[model samples]
Target: MSDIIVFGIDFTSAPSARKPIRVAAGVRQGAVTRLNGLMALPSLDAFSDWLAQPGPWVAGFDLPFGLPRELVEHLGWPTDYAALMAHYAALSRAEIRDLFAAFCDARPAGGKFAHRACDGPAGASPSMKWVNPPVAWMLHAGVPRLIAAGVHLASLLPGDESRVALEAYPGLLARELIARRSYKSDTKAAQTPERLIARKDIVDALEQGRTRLGLRLKLSHAQRDELVADASGDSLDAVLAMLQAAWAASRPRYGWPDAVDPLEGWIASA
Candidate 1:
């Protein structure tokens, strides 16, 4: 059996004890991926420690790994992926907001944000957006930790070969099963019956192997209940990400395409 554990991370830029980063852990055997556990990282330090653990694992992290190549060029940031990450990590959130806002101000209306190549196909937000999902902050928070932990980011950077991290987005997979249907929401008021039904539909589809990835999600009875009960959707997103990681593990280059821009790293299964 392969010793590689698969992990899916639902990341938060500023994790607290109340709103910690959520992770779904699992392992694959043949065509089925069995979810093993869920984790809540109380802080960035805990997340860092988890990544630094000694193991051979492939992780699908729900965080943007790179900015749009066009944005980087326009801002005169280093073209080198590693260097750009270094420069980015050094800035405060306020600085990032100011810089990005300035960039947007210069652009024409209706297209304020620069996007990575994979964004169009994945139907994802631009990595530069700081509000709503705050993916930009997620990138700021997550990438540096991956770098410090020495995890190889497929085409983006080579680090700890055993601990390979790929950019994963749960929406990319969820959309495949349920087109634009809202599933889970963080707010209690927004967790409608329709969203609950959507979550169940998504779970059912996964169990039926209804995705292009062709991997069945195996869950215990208790696990299924736990997944359906979480109105926040964090746990479900992690599982979705784990499925992506499992799929990537089965293919070469961690399932990254040949044309993926190294500077603008591609999302796994995008």
Candidate 2:
């Protein structure tokens, strides 16, 4: 497992200079995963290019790889996973928002957002949600590019085995350490000392091998400082994702669940 590049991507539905797609690149050697560096892809094109790169690399992307199976069934879309993605990729974002909003409107308040099987375990937002976290848009914006880039979408759409893409939620690991203390804010006004402390706690936990992933995060002092300093938490989220990738790569089945629902891709190590 040593020297295989592991990438963690904190993706954005709309990438730009202000909020570029953040990537944390590293490699796993035994139980310690070392941070190589970080980079930002400012456009979808750049992200696409990144995906097409030659790999013996495995990645955990902070985006939904599939929509809810219930939602797909309700819409009478393709039941097959690959076909469902294609049908989904053809729709406009506005079309998606409208459909999802209508679905919510017809359902009871508590039962509005239909979820994938992995959502509850991962503590992830619904893949069909178009507001707040807007992960539906993420699925739209990110997954198609992964498809066109010809990378394997582990369990959902197979491509290059060496270039694997796994769904990952940083919150899954963060909550393990900090218990839902908010550690990031896109708004500077909301980036409080409390959040900074929370970020530090997360970093410490990863460095100390406190999480259930069982792999320690190896960071230079400067790298540790860099992860903590970014109040937006994008960098740390990317690293957290990388940790998930590292955990998967260290194990059999790429750390995915046994018999994953093709319509609802599993989050690595969830």
Candidate 3:
């Protein structure tokens, strides 16, 4: 086993005791990636502390690290990505909603939300969307903490060398294995047997190294069952992120294209 700690973080806009941020911690060796541990950060403070922990580690976070270039340009926000993040972090959620809404209001129909370039290939939610996934708020909440943690944001922000953070979308990897089958939900009523089965299928595929990522997941029977039993699927999502982190560790620029938009960060392995 290598000393390089790899992580997959399933982030939330609002972390709380009821639905804490979920994380999967692992280490990769050759073609096998082993689950090292799992954690929950019930508050942003806890998550910030986790981000500040000493590393020799790299993490995959399931959140957009930047806004749409078009939106940023139209809003006349700072062109530099770090400056833009700082500007964005200063606003309240209400202000964010209002400004983004106004941007959409001025745009023509069917193009209400402007998206980052990587969003198209990753099938990700628009970073500007305040509803549904509320990823815009996620960017507001999560990105600033990353900035404060001083962790290097792979191709985007340069900070601590030992701790590298990459933007990851578990859906990008999950769909490669299971297509569009639903695997998880937050509501009790939406957590069906079919979803449970789908989660199991994903786990099985990872263990068998069936996906194009070429990294097999290593988990004890108890760990495997625990991942399968989490009806909310946060754990599974974390594991998916972990796999992506593992894939990115030794790659040049963490597998991102050389021409990634500095204003809009690229998703790892997309």
Residue lDDT tens for model 2, 1-270: 356689999999999998999999999988889999999999999999889889899999999999888889998999998899899999998998898888999999799889889999989999998878989889999999999988888778889988989888999999999997999999989999999999999999999999999989999999999999999999999999999999987678787778788888898889
Q: What is the TM-score of each candidate against the true structure?
A: 0.97, 0.98, 0.98
User: Could you give candidate 1's per-residue lDDT for residues 12-127 as a string of tens digits?
Assistant: 99999878899999998878898999989999999999998876889999999999999999989999989999999999999999999999999999999999999998888999
lDDT of each: 0.91, 0.91, 0.92
Displacement of the residue 110 alpha carbon in candidate 1, Å = 1.6
Displacement of the residue 14 alpha carbon in candidate 3, Å: 1.0
Q: Give the TM-score of candidate 1.
A: 0.97
Q: What is the lDDT ranking, best to worst? A: 3, 2, 1
**Which tens-of-lDDT digit does each residue in 1-270 have in candidate 3?**
454579999999899999999999999988899998899999999999999889899899999999989999998999998889999999999998999999999989999999899999999999899999988888888999999999998777899999999999999999998899999999999999999999999999999999888889999999999999999999999999999989999788889998888889989889
Q: Which 10 successive residues of model 1 have the least lDDT summed?
A: 1-10
